[model samples]
Target: MISILFLIAVAASIITAIMGLSFLISCIWEKETRAALYAGLQFLLMLGLVFLLFYLEATAFFETATGRAGLILGLVLTGGTFALLTLRIGSNPQALQGTRGLMVGNVKRYDERDIVFARNRTLSPGLEQYQAYYELHPEHEQYDAARRKRGGPLGKPGSIDKPQDRPNVAATLASLSIPLHLSTPEKFNPSQHPEFSQQRVELSPASASARIKGYTLSIGAKLVGITEINPLWIYANRGEIFNENWDDWGREIELTHKYAVVFATEMGFELVGTAPHSSTTIASMANYASGAFIATQLAAFIANLGYSATANHLRHYDAALVPLAVDAGLGETGRLGYLMTKDFGPRVRLGAVTTDLALIPDNPVDIGVEDFCKICKKCAHCCPSNSIPLDDQEAVNGTRRWKLNAETCFDYWGKVGTDCNICMRVCPWSHANTSPHKLIRTLITRNRYSRYLFNSMDDIFYGRKPKPKPAPEWARFDE
Candidate 1:
């Protein structure tokens, strides 16, 4: 029996050593230098401990009652700790079920004009739309004026002192010309195109849903979901695209669609590592463009299917993509005001298509994002502009959510010459999708204790305010 107990200890030590070594390798691959160092030191310490255990056995220390009892206690405690981290032992404290707690009151329709981008970019002074918007809401004038002086995010003489290099400029121009400055809504949506005004084929709701979801995945969408359209999620009117000289600018957007299919595309983990840099903006643009292309193609496919569908991309949104994504069962909103996906965390770009086609809708999921965010305020702590809220969630727009200060956040963008994505970069959920991280992510959405455990570990492994990584070689800039 004593020999058997010794053998068990040996096997347990081997398993733990493998885990430690694998994590050390994964951290190196993830470019987490600090974490890699930590992993390395931890692996060595475990190796030393294992050796010490064997040395004691060699010295016949286990013959003593005190040594045997100590070994047993150590094994028991170690087993309990691992089980606590890995097992699902209890119910969530407050995770909503099937979207039941999505809304606590009347969800008010949001005005797209109030979005920071619209207030600063599209509603430029000297435009009629700009004058009308300011006249209606004089309160925004002071904030808008401050942002205007700072110039655009890619301003050559902007806050980031580093040179904006040629490749960076080209990428920014491509993003603007392709999505924002060049294409209009009519060009983006197939249903709006005169040639595809009519549907050609028809299929049952069940078949249509499956086909659409499959196609979405095939065409670069990492995640896809379907849900009944919630009118409250739709914007009350257009604002951002008003001055692009379309008649529908600022017009009431009444999308009477019964269903909405949402798509989420994963942003490159390495690319996002270089947050607050021009490379980060490049990542954002690339994903947004990919989402636009995928959504547009899908709308055309639906038009061919004899259904009325309207694509909602970054450049042509009639509704809030995050809310639509949540309703579509893709993920839940986090405190940082981004979708926290089960697989990709907050590192995803969302696109949607609202349609009148009869399709089965997916139920909203509870991934413990609400409960996890409550304890893990990493995003709030790391936001460069202090835009994210550190306090508890409050009722906003008829729901409980952490509201980000968009104006200050965008202002920091102008100062940095890029979208300061420190929040996304520092979020523990946004960690690289390695095996160890996957294990942690599973526990995060399961037991609440895992949230607290991993939260502290994240801070220790990656620092409370982690530094941004250098950009990809091609887009690299001198510090």
Candidate 2:
């Protein structure tokens, strides 16, 4: 009996050690030095405990029934330790409750051209849009004037030392050469088609819709969810849509589509590490293209199934995306006010397809992210333009949340010629998912105590404000 028990104990210890070692190796593969160290320490600790048990046995500490009972107690405790560690590694609370919607009110309808207008205004000797904008917000003129003098990302004396603009512009132009207007149903004039008035499409049942979404998302998209229509997610119209006196413009523009599908394409992290560079621009445009393709294809597929659907992609949009994404169970909004999904943080580009199809609505997930972001202002601290807010989430219009300075943020992007993702690059949530990070995410979700620990540790491991890395070779055209 003693021999058999000893053999079992040894086997269990060996298996535990192997798992720990495997996790350590996996961490190294992800370039996570801290995770590897943590994993190695866990393995060593287990080994020491097992060896100590063996020493006690040999020294006659468990020769009697009482000693044997004590031996059993130690083994059970050791097994519990392993279970606890396993739980920490496997459970991600953020993934638990699915999607949620943010019902924002009182916010003014920002023009689609607002960002472009803001950027242009910040440039030296600004354009007509700049003067018009300043007439509304006169206090911003001084700051705008100062920022405009800095050369843009693609401008002369920009971030790139050589200052080369229009990388593969020929290729980009060729791609855009294909008539994009024809892609829009409204532009194509659906009324012109004889069958358009005669044919009607039916929505699939909720169960079938779920299956379809699951199957289609598995095709390539990173994450997918279905959400009910929310009025706040739509924009009160602006720009040409507003100027044309369209009834839907500048109103709560909720669609008849009962189901909204939100999915994300992973941003190549290695490429994003090189912010304010040509490579970063390339990656951003590439993701936009990829998202557009995915959304277009999905919309077409839904239409073929006899249901009306529309794909909202890059460049053109009629509704707000982040709230829709959150409602669809994608992720919660983080400190940077970007949708921070469970798997990718802000390292994703989003696309959506709305349809009349029936589907299950995901529950709102609370992984303590709001609380964490409240305390962790790493992004705000590192923001070069100081556009991100450092204070608590406040009521903007009516809904309570952090409202980013759109003008300042857009101004920075315009000057850089690239969407400055300095905040995304430095976000603690953007860290590569490794065992230690997984453990920390789990603990923080469960106990407030762990939140404090992780907030500090994250800064120590990766600096409170990390510097941007060099652009990747594959993305660099002017090497």
Q: Report lDDT per candidate.
A: 0.81, 0.64
lDDT of 2 by residue, 202-221 (tens): 54476656666775576678
State the lDDT of candidate 1 residue by residue for 153-203, as single tens digits.
874556473664457757866875555532465555555345655635667
Stretches of candidate 2 off by over 4 Å are: 1-23, 32-157, 160-198, 215-219, 240-258, 357-359, 414-417, 433-450, 467-471, 476-479
lDDT of 2: 0.64
The 10-residue segment of model 2 with minimum total lDDT is 239-248
lDDT (C-alpha) at residue 125 in model 2: 49
**Estimated TM-score for each candidate:** 0.93, 0.73
